[model samples]
Target: MPLPLHHLRAGIIGTGFIAPVHIEALKRLGVQVTAISGSTKGTQALAEQWGTPEVYGDYDYQSLINSPNVDVVHITSPNRVHVEQSLAALAAGKHVVCEKPLGMTTEETAKVVAAAAASDRVFAVNYLCRFYPAILQMRAMVQRGELGRIIHVQGHFFQDWLLKDTDYNWRVLSSEGGKLRAVGDIGTHWIDAVSFILGARAKSVFATLETFHKTRYRPTGEVQTFTSQSDPASMVPYEVDTEDFGSVLLKFGQADHGHVSGTHANCAISQVAAGWKCSLYVGIYGTKGSVQWEFQQPNEIQAGYRDQPNQVLTRNTAGFDKDVANFTDNPGGHAEGFPDGHKMHYRAVYEHIASGKSTPVLYATADDGHYEVKLCEAILRSSEKQTWVGV
Candidate 1:
């Protein structure tokens, strides 16, 4: 008999902002979060807060991977260590759900792809934005030719958390977070969601990247993501190498679904956009109609028509229920946004594992993750050369 989803235990490998989100979602799914690993200062506290039994502090993820209590490994660590930890977990016969970008570059992520392919274990990349009910509904419409022949897509993923020069995170440094900061950190979420909805991959890219702050101040000691530094006197200055903003144009290949072929897309990615906390807005236009949705308002999608009346489709309601019934739990009026996206994503992944891999793969796979990294590399190259670059 296949194991129950709740019986398959999870081990988390980071204690940053995203790590707790993973823990909360897993707990909501009734999965046993048995182990937590990260810096010694906060690992135990996080474990205690979540009621996880095993704690591997001082970044000792190898020990956590080898733990008998852990059946699945969730790599939420910094970008630099994702490949190393993922490779280790796969070797130890554990399923993996890694945070996106997969690795710093395509070269390292390719190794992970090979490792995941060689093993029977399930490997997923945390492109959780795909689980949003509105996204799924849009995808179903596109596949069913409800959107008609695809024309183009335009959107922007903007955030203001890192807007100021004193706003510092490890992600601001190229050496720490890889080359593309705004694009890699949050823009990939937008790109992956678009690909998932359109049922296609970006074939080539033309991009322009800029660093608004050539030099920024950082605290002498490390700070967790989204946390503020109190003392300006204790700050030190460093040169910023990663981009603060990017504009990218993409040409996507044909989807097996007859309605979508050779779609054009453009996206503006930025970390310096003031007043927008975390807004990912996407508008898909086609020959028949158009659909628009934003991350800030996740519960509904606006469907536009040329001659007929436009419609506001709400989650769990008519026109939206059929496509995303399995992913959403709340009733029509109740709001489910960011946290719920993570919950639904883990639910899909966990159900697949519990069913002996019989469930359809809605989650992003190792190859999908690797392709996103390749896209990032292409974006960087295109920005440098000021021309189109194939992914």
Candidate 2:
């Protein structure tokens, strides 16, 4: 029997765009969001907005972690502090659902892996792309040999939020985000989702990265992601160190399922692609057939076959089987996109915690998160050296 998710109380650290996403998703799952910690400017307002009782301002996440009211901690802070906050949350015996890329470096992320391994708590990385029903259905098909002997995968994650020289966010800086901006921020979602569907990990990577805007302007004060500041007088110019766009080629290793081994995959990731907003596309081709999905059109997938006519499989319909039904809430024709993915992801995590870790581990673990960071480092090296680097 499954336990009630309402019993788990969550505390969130960070007041950025993704923080409210975490809060709203937890609420939808009947989980109480008791505490919120972040900058003094936004923490109290955010708490009041959600009627949360405890507010830890000035980025004081330690207090939030120590609070008896919080059973789980959601680390949505910037990339640099993920490790410190995660370690603190673990030591406090709090279950954690941290935002991705784990940390800035593999060395620091390894500590989180070790810490999570030593603890009995449930730790998850917010790679919520795995929760999409289409992705889940595709994984089921691959595992069942419906898509026989996976051949190659192709996709791209593109956005125009950072297209202009004046458009700025903390992610544009290597110091605030990681060394790789577009890849680390969104590209990993593509890679992780593909890995989940294929039941394999990328063994090596060949990447080419480019920074389109050599110099970009930012406002004197910090602004939330996707927020616009158009006045040139209020901005100052700085040299951009991170890539605005990149193309990556990956060679995946064997999966436990006999269908896939040594598969080839390529992806294009960009934050500067004009008019495209949060578009993530994935196509997996196999000997038997192929499945294609786009984030913009989350409700259906295009399944291609050589011998027969291709079909469009919509969620909660005939082609989507019982395996993916649990991940989706709405019926056929009702559109569920980005926010629903977050909700389902949190539902899976909270259920695992509520059920005493008896539920299937569908969410990304600490080790998976660590591997992504390591892969990001390898991608950076590969881009610089113009050669394939082993992950």
Candidate 3:
């Protein structure tokens, strides 16, 4: 319980696909994932596969939290369990790093924000997209007025994982995923990224949400993400309560400076474009120039100006700003993709926690996660009422 949290012991609370990513990132930061909690199906195997020293049943997550072997808890479970488990860990004086939509609703998130504020333990939210080197560069440009007078922002987070009617997952069920699927799962990332870059919060949102296939077939057996069983004989169709797609129009708060029309800037977000897989595209248009970044091109940014030729700014360019270039892990040609984003994010968290210092702006804290929930609630309200709602 002190400074220099290097070699910290971590307890992970889920064995889903996201858990492995967290494990890998923690490993890169010299953290030991000493324990894990999971369902009976694969708990042992997952522990063995990852070389975790101990395992707990899903119901025993609290026991894992109380164990002396764990110093931190990483909650990667379904939406319904995040707030409860995180509260437990905070109450136990353990630091926490929970997945996005930290709480399913604004009310739940408020409780988490309050609890974290009252405690001395570190709390982080996983909004990994912000850690990309290209994204850091974009933020620097906006901060330096390199993209003078920000005018508009637009982005989309698309995936083909649920494109087929046979796709099935807990996310489609409101009981597990909350009232929103597409917006909560992926749209938050899009919203968080642009907000982080522009240094603004969404003031209002006009939105529409839709579920293309009201029902989908679930295979009788287990299945992984992005892969679905197509056999009708073994698949059973069930009604889906959450949306598969969402589009939102957003108005942002005014920045201190560098805004074209003060609070008049707007943004649009999408999660259901066909044929696109895990694509997160964000662009900011300003009076002087414009810049765009895509997850597919994580190492480069497309920038254009009114009178000059457009340039693609790759990471680690010699003439680039030093602060932005520091985010680059290697020379210009070496690419840093999704996994690297996770690593950089965890590194920031590790550095802050290890130093026993105040939380840095570079890491997404519970407060930031709560604001994202506020925006999500407004989006849902607007979609239902067919009018703009304050965020």
- Highest lDDT: which candidate? 2
Q: What TM-score, computed on C-alpha atoms, does each candidate reach?
A: 0.98, 0.99, 0.94
Off by over 4 Å in 2: none
Superposed by TM-score, candidate 1 places the C-alpha of residue 301 at a distance from the truth, in angstroms, of 0.2
lDDT for each residue of candidate 3 in 167-278, tens digit (9 for 90 to 100): 7887878898889788888888988888888888889888999888887888766565556677777888899888888778888887665553333433433334667888
- If both were scored by TM-score, which would come out higher, candidate 2 or candidate 3? 2
Clashing pairs in 2: none
Alpha carbon deviation, residue 41, candidate 2 (Å): 1.9
> Relative to the unseen true structure, what is the C-alpha lDDT of residue 84 in candidate 1, on a scale of 0 to 100?
96
What shift in Å separates residue 249 of candidate 2 from its native position after superposition?
0.3
Please, what are the lDDT tens digits per residue for candidate 1 over residues 44-107? 9998898889999999999999999999999999899999999999999999999987999999
Worst 10 residues of 3 by lDDT: 260-269
